[model samples]
Target: MLESEYQNRRKPPRHLVPAAPSQAEFSYTLREATTEDLPSVLALYRHYVRNSVVTFDEKPPTLRAFRAQFEHTHKLGYPFVVAQSPSGDILGYARVQLFRDKAAFRHTVESTIYLGPASTGRGLGRALLTELIDRCEAAGIREMIAVIADSGAEASLALHEKLGFTETGRMGKVGYKFGRWIGIVMMQKSLRRK
Candidate 1:
């Protein structure tokens, strides 16, 4: 082949994935969630509850329960973030909640994140999770905990690991559903630099 032909045939540099919400590729914005976001949030949660082992519940939480979650988190001053498309579509959500009711556990919080099946694998999970960590740190939270179902270990575990969380405990046969018992992985991140 001629040198010019070879040069011209070389693949053009691939374009970057644009962020969501914009007409751009895969980009999105993370913002505080509101009650209006509950439907989409429940839809995503129910999708996994009904279709995957990501959660141990045999039945999805009711809309009433989800509303209570919003109220409870707000009362506790936890950060609830929604990953949104520029067009106002919610792609995913992440939040931090009090780890326990005991006084000694007040400085610690457990975090949870959920992404729509359509929104997974686009880096939205990581983005939302990192924001959860940031919000916890800013709130003087001393530790961030994650309770992961054994079957949901991949992305959730990897995301926590990337954010410096360490696996601290594992409880076998702690969750029962679908006529089966499942294990649990508990991970924690120290919010303080120390």
Candidate 2:
């Protein structure tokens, strides 16, 4: 589906939707990410890896490792994009990867979005995800799945719900993080109608 077409679809209830980022808070630009952006992207993800259950990685990957991951995504032709400040700082990023390695899963993709700590609540996440969805649909992807760790992540859950994803399943006590058990929430959005 096209971005405009997706925007025209019916949204969930207002209360379920996150408040729009105030104009004063959303003065960034969105664009395709490049290899040079990997350092900043890793930096943003490091926070989540170290302090939050959002990611299960206890230790962040090295720059070379991150670069290899980025290159792999690029080689697969999946979208890897970033939100940038006017001064060239990366505010956030979103990307889509194959949901599974099997040939039958070719039409499905899993999404990952991360924003700088200071960049949250400013609509950058939504913007990045929206673009990712558009690009995925345009590329003939049939489904987008979010394996969201920590079911307590209200903002991330609400954002996906608002964008037409439905809660498909949940896994309990699957991730050990921060000295506690973290549950996973599986949310899915179909980009094309059957």
Candidate 3:
């Protein structure tokens, strides 16, 4: 299904329903991403590549490569979203990719999320993830999986757990980065009942 069609079918949680805002409240906007957001999105991922093992990549992909990835996900009818400040700064992004190539795996997706370095610890990640899950569920995705990079990634683990994901599996010492072997933790949440 096209994204716009899927969006029209989405039933956002009550808090996100459109209503005039009170002057005392502040809110961030979550919306479908465009190629124009790639530079900022790539920069955010680059920080993790150079300084952390959150992603296994040792080097950041070029902007062209990143744009190709964004397009591929969009073409598959999956959501690629960005969280923006009221002033329009791109604070973070989240998206889903095919969990595997097999035909039977079509109902599942792997999720990725990243925030600008300064945007951490402010609940933005949860907001992005929550919206992603909602959209996926609306589109009839049966499951969402998160392949967290390491067991030491407490914040990521906690965020997924808080959103009803459970640890499903782990591969010890499966990834080598930063001069050590890092483990992969697999977590999953069911989007719908059978």
Candidate 4:
């Protein structure tokens, strides 16, 4: 069908619609997150929570809960960093937290990274994750884990792999979100140099 004919027949689905070319140059600085940044960070997370299965969270997080996480990460001496745009907006965030509460798991951390929808495809995700890994290594962290949604999170899986993570295991049908079954792929990267 001709382009005009196709337009008249049916409107393109929102997800299928082409996005306007980004006009601004992509630029951001990576730095440790502050208490003041908790709100913006949560907003970025809410974007995924509401629209995608990338996160298993079915509801947006409350500020108090997010604050507690921020505090806990810091209290454990883990890194919580953000990518700030030139306009002072938070483009994305990356952080590491204790993988488990047991003392035996002290050297193991779980890495989590999230970028706003508009920040996707830019190099921010890579930069943010790299910084997180570097910080973890600097702090004597021995291992980093990435638990990614197996479905609808291919980009995250690919990013982790590009950063030298390897799949360790997978648990199928472990989560339910958006009324659909989803699973997790566990990826691990050694932060300690041999």
Candidate 5:
């Protein structure tokens, strides 16, 4: 192989990958993250970072940074859950983060969820979100937000509405991708206050 080609093939070091899927009935569990789970978590995020607009990040985050993100959220007492099968394959993940960095926005937080391509339509999104809201209520989060890329994410929009979120904002031509410009839809849910 050409030296340039060989150089291009070098991969960055990786973290500990989780064990392979375990065969069992259709069951899943939601729990807080651990240092050990970062690799699997990064793997899932890398999928969307590479293949979809599920998140705005143009490049995959390093596993070390991904692990630190979870650590920070955990310290803030927010919900960050990993859904796993009985044998420990991560099917998806969901987490809540501060809506903005300003002190005044602390009560408001943004919600993000990602599912493995093969795991959609099995109701895991609903389960993950239910737990997210449960944690929000417990932690006294006043408002939850979602900024969805508007090539028209129907399923996401539908799910948010079904979960009592309402459209609060929209920006036209705010996101450019796939050789075109697209809009962004922002939705929110108010919790436990008038």
Candidate 6:
């Protein structure tokens, strides 16, 4: 069919991405995540692992594996949060895990956050991250670290900086993924409340 004829046929477009919701229309409840949220959390995370360079994990973790990690963090009294929409959907999730397994690192935590594709640029990340910081402070966390990819994650880096995190250091060409070299930018924030 000619282009004009095809247009006249009124065939619907395919694979179109929906526009992000505006701040006025977007609202969510921020709260601690539960075991029941594991599946949704895992699915949200898999989106990043499969499609984005923000995470170093080239392969998505299994539900069982993610559950094990979540349980460990919960058992250790770390903060795990989910931002749920009014209609009961997990728009994003955040967590703080031990920075290292050593005893000297007990007071330090590494922050991780992931938002759904349609949820970006709607202020959801900032809200989720602020909640994570507040919870980590309440949990007596002295330090919070964010490890972000050097490629295609500038927004995350800027968000961390806007929240009082400083670029502590960087590792160059450490992550090899998607047939290219990627690095990490490490930012840290002191959570010691005066």
Segments in model 4 whose C-alpha atoms lie over 4 Å from true places: 1-22
Q: Model 6: per-residue lDDT, tens digit, 49-142? A: 8888899899999999998999999998999999999999999999988899999999999999999988999999999999999988888889
Q: What would the TM-score be for candidate 3 when compared with the true structure?
A: 0.83
- What is the lDDT of every predicted structure here? 0.85, 0.88, 0.89, 0.92, 0.83, 0.92
The stretch of ten residues in a row with the least summed lDDT in candidate 4 is 5-14
Model 5 spans with C-alpha error above 4 angstroms? 1-25
The superposed Cα distance between candidate 4 and the true structure at residue 165, in angstroms, equals 0.2
Listed in order, each prediction's TM-score against the native is 0.83, 0.84, 0.83, 0.87, 0.82, 0.87
Give the alpha carbon lDDT tens digit for every residue of 1-194 in model 1.
99999997785655744545654487689988899889888888888788777687778899999899789988878899999988877889999877888889988888889887778888898899988888877777888889998875688888889889899999999887666888889998888632
Q: What is the model-wide C-alpha lDDT for candidate 1?
A: 0.85
lDDT of 1 at 59: 88
The residue ranges of model 2 lying beyond 4 angstroms of the native Cα positions read: 1-25
Root-mean-square deviation of every model: 6.1, 12.7, 15.3, 5.8, 13.0, 6.6
Q: Please give, for residues 146-171, the per-residue lDDT of candidate 4 as tens digits.
A: 99999998989999999999999999
The C-alpha local distance difference test score for the whole of candidate 5 amounts to 0.83
Give the Å error, residue 169, model 3.
0.6
Clashes of 3: 0
Q: Tell me the tens digit of each residue's lDDT in model 3 across 139-171.
A: 789999999977457899999999999999999
lDDT of 6: 0.92
